[model samples]
Target chain A: EADIYQTPRYLVIGTGKKITLECSQTMGHDKMYWYQQDPGMELHLIHYSYGVNSTEKGDLSSESTVSRIRTEHFPLTLESARPSHTSQYLCASSPPGGANYGYTFGSGTRLTVV
Target chain B: AQTVTQSQPEMSVQEAETVTLSCTYDTSENNYYLFWYKQPPSRQMILVIRQEAYKQQNATENRFSVNFQKAAKSFSLKISDSQLGDTAMYFCAFMPLNNNDMRFGAGTRLTVKP
Candidate 1:
């Protein structure tokens, strides 16, 4: 079955360590997004990509950057991890936006930076 | 800018009972979409239901349904015959018809008791 996938379901890293969260969808959706889920269980959009080579930051500002080099892949990278960065990262994808479309989200990656 | 809000921070329902989670959004655009998502303890975000602003009828999926009041800018989710698996953090989201970004509300944690 076609689905979105996020690797490293859980990660623990030291402060200042560089890390990448991988997100890929086999559905061939044109739009993909990354959301940071806080301890309060609220989700905040951090980044999104309309298509390959087109990426933009979302409402929530973050030190991480994302790249969409392939239609199926959108990866988020933190140049240097910090304790404050510890949270669940969720990746989602939906067919080109504008119309009413529901997203297919992947099981998030729980990152804990010490 | 669009903003989504979930008034209830937490709620509980006995198994086989019904529960409603309220969600309100602020948006100037007439054409938009509303969504309800469920995040389980495992942290997998799942789409529960969706409602279109242009449609007068509410959307329903199995035991889940939505009460969409476009004039009031309110969209709420009603879970019928709640089960153990229904215990999770529920989030309300809003997306404009012309905008690619989606705004999510702080979730409401729902616990289904046996």
Candidate 2:
């Protein structure tokens, strides 16, 4: 089983509330990523980190921000959550420098901005 | 920029039948990686199979197999004897050898009917 974990499998918050989605992996992977997805839709990359203290935005533009303070932890924060920010957020990690290897993904956090 | 495309929005297969899902990608890199991931209702992304662009042989796992046409930039997943447990959203992904991020296509929702 994959060692990655995401907390709060589901979240419902009022608009303008600040929310943070937590992601952590125990596999010691150097690369971590965050993706946004909607029901029955494709996943859009929002942010990624090459290692601790490193972060980069993905191809898709996103209002949220992410932090990689530690190698195993990557967290995404939405300063003022809105209805448009309501979507499932997925976290994934892969071994360092193995482009051929697939990622191990978390169970995702389904956020609902009411 | 690399882009993956899954033309089918939804697909269905009867129990013990076979099904194939098509995916195509556009990339300037000659050597890269392709993947098929399955996300069940539980919202966990599971790696189903992967293919290396440099390898001519298609990759297969128990009931899952891929037909990878490097020249055509086409990768398709074939499920043999589909089961109800196979019901999920299937996504095609591409990762260039030089990049750490994987680009995903709009997913295809697969319904395995009993």
Report the number of the highest-lDDT candidate.
Answer: 2
lDDT of 1 by residue, A1-114 (tens): 329999999999999999999999998899999999886656888998889999999888899999999999999999999999999999999896433677889998999999
What are the per-residue Cα lDDT tens digits for candidate 1 across B54-100? Answer: 99999999999999998899999999999999999999998888776
DockQ score for candidate 1: 0.68
lDDT of 2 at A19: 92
Model 1: residues with Cα > 4 Å off, grouped in runs:
A97-99
On a 0 to 1 TM-score scale, where does candidate 2 land against the true structure? Answer: 0.96
DockQ by candidate, in order:
0.68, 0.75
Give all candidate RMSDs, comma-separated.
1.5, 1.2
TM-score per candidate, in order?
A: 0.95, 0.96
lDDT of 2 at B28: 85
lDDT of 2 by residue, A5-102 (tens): 99889999999999999999999999999999986567888999989899999877999999998999999999999999989899999887764688
The collision pairs in model 1 are none
